[model samples]
Target: MYTVSQDCTFTKLRSDSTLRVLFSGSLRLKCKNACCQRWYFTFNGAECTGPLPIESIIYLDQGSPELNSTINIHRTSSVEGLCEGVKSGLVDVAVWVGTCADYPRGDASTGWNSVSRIIIEELPK
Candidate 1:
């Protein structure tokens, strides 16, 4: 669990203030045919409904799709979205990621000679 904010208080956000989440990372996925990965930020343990989630669709090598290759490729992606209608006094912000694809025999790794980051900011509403 990643800590987005820690002001030593639960009420870090006010009703007049709005918060947004940003995720930046590189994903390494093995492409057999095609794969679509979904990523989203969770507000204090629940999925945020304020902004659209991130979607990454990767296809097999155009040159060869039936090759039984066991290699993974790296793709960098970033997503930033607002968290609307969130409950007040929430302190912890989390991130969620999952893979959905046919014949999902591949694995995803976020650590590949790169650092992942998550930033949360408060804005005046």
Candidate 2:
């Protein structure tokens, strides 16, 4: 189970623009559940239809519990075509965490934790 506590929306991005997705949060696992967790970003809205071309995998263990990561996406001519239908409207960008069986046992809710924040920012040319 995965919960998104915060989501950042963007509307002014152009086909020629490049952007970076910043994700920050923390994770804690009991015992020796240290493992690699994979996460990805998806776009859902009037124009965009599916997951972006970026993905990340982070390792979480008793030694390290904090997560701070970034994924950069460039809107090239080829990829820009995918967003042409978007026109001018807010697009919802989401971050999803991959499932892991080692998640704390108990209620499904206990198996997941909240993502502190997901931010989208345009990069300078």
Give each prediction's root-mean-square deviation over alpha carbons. 5.1, 10.8
What is the C-alpha lDDT profile of model 1 across 9-113, one tens digit per residue? 234557666677676778665655554444556666666665544333344432244576555778676767777666667566665556454534345556467
Work out the TM-score per prediction. 0.69, 0.45
lDDT of each: 0.57, 0.42
Residue-level lDDT of model 2, residues 15-90, one tens digit each, is: 4555555555543222233444444555562213332444544444433224442222111110121222333346
